[model samples]
Target: MTVRTTDTPVRVMIVDDHEVVRRGIVTVIDASPALTVVGEASTVDEARRRLPAVRPDVLVVDLQLPDGTGIDVMTRARELSPEQRMLVLTSFDDDAALRESRAVGAAGMLLKSARSRDIVAAIEKIAEGQTVWPSRPAEDEEELSATDQRIVELIGDGCTNREIADELGIAEKTVKNRITAILHSLGLQRRTQVAAREAARRRAGWK
Candidate 1:
């Protein structure tokens, strides 16, 4: 298990478009001894303006912002500070959004319906460099061949089919066929999902 090296509270920034929700989150964060709210924003524009200055240890963001999206904020945050940790706190349980968050390096995701304690714990875990995604059933887990695993890693590295093919010393058609098989094996429909899964695995320090 990962442990924090310091006793200081985890600094947090909230980006949600709802006033009531934001206030409630602020309350929950303030109630925690291990977490503190450094800033809050109700719009994407506001978040972008304040993010660099505040530089919170974790950013808890909602997906549907007035000006843009949580994805936009997370992407920009990554550009500004690659080490910035983020958590998605959204009402929408969207697979695409989740995959996008992982692709952009969010440490975790939580539904707005989650208990307050879960939210606090998620923030704490994210601050400690741990992932807190929703748990999948055992049946959803699947093992991949070594070649497929390498392809997943290449996809996570943003390699195109041709690039992966050349790097693996295989034909492009073979690469595509392998990716299709991988998608089916993983119960995923899109290449982005494969990439996102690989990214999350790496972030969690999985071999």
Candidate 2:
């Protein structure tokens, strides 16, 4: 549950390359009594330039930008303000993008197809320091063997491939091969994504 500590509406910033999409989100947010639109940007560069000045409570950003991806914007924002809250609102339902956004500390993710009310609700939750991420399918977790799960846990603990191999009594080459297979099975592109997802699951009390 999310609860606001002040009467001030949660200030929101919208970043999307499409003007119409930005406006639509802006409208939805402003219509909420608990949220307000404070600024807007169409590119990662613009977002970087305006973020500090706007000092928004939450940033609602699209994954694809004219200058760079939304991950770039979130990364920069995290550098500038470690406590900054963000939400990814994009047309694409990409697992890689979701993991990247989570790694960069986005508080929530919503597709553009989500209802306007749902978007506003997510912003409110994020503003209050609550997360609103979609749960990964159980079948995805079932795909990992016990060994693969152990590898993921080790990676999340900040172990390198060589370290993981030494810990598991396996050759480094075998560890690399297993990691490659893990990435393929989980629809991830990098070990960092696996680590991030595993860390998130731990935080969520998943075994």
Candidate 3:
């Protein structure tokens, strides 16, 4: 939860690569009495350039873009205006992306799969400085989940995807999918890196 420091109409920016999608969001915001569309961007560079000038209270952004990502935009936006609340409005609902959003300090996240009304409501809530969505599970100590440890253990043991699958009694594809997810959770690029980090942790007496 948060509290707004300003009394102005909720100034909003929409950053989506799709023109139709941007226009549609603008239409919805324009209809709302408490909200106003201050600016719009279809690319990360454009959004980066325009975001500060507009000084929006809330930023509604898509995940993917031609030049960069909404996460990239928000990362820069946070540096410029840390007080501004950002709402992730994207088609992606995966845990990794959500975790990344939380890492970068987005106020909330909503999927494109959500209803138009629900999207608007999320925007309104964020604009009002209220957290509106469930955040990714992040603990103070970055407590790794049991599944994360299993993946790390297999990776550290130099187990291939098939090997991990056989050991865990799951399909190889499932192991591969979980590896991708584990990489995201750990903010790593490859499975080998997960293995390296997990080995270091074990060396430090972490089970």
Clashes in model 1: which pairs? none
> Residue 118 of model 2: what lDDT?
91
Give lDDT: candidate 2, residue 122.
Answer: 88
Clashing pairs in model 3, backbone N/Cα/C closer than 3 A: none
lDDT of each: 0.85, 0.84, 0.79
What TM-score does model 3 achieve against the real structure?
0.68
lDDT of 3: 0.79
TM-score of each: 0.67, 0.68, 0.68
> In candidate 1, which residue ranges exceed 4 Å CA deviation?
1-4, 137-207
Residue 126 alpha-carbon offset, candidate 3, angstroms: 1.0
Give per-residue CA lDDT, model 3, range 38-72, as digits (tens): 99999989999997799888999898889767778
Ranking of models by lDDT: 1, 2, 3
Question: Residue 112 in model 2: shift from native, Å?
Answer: 0.5
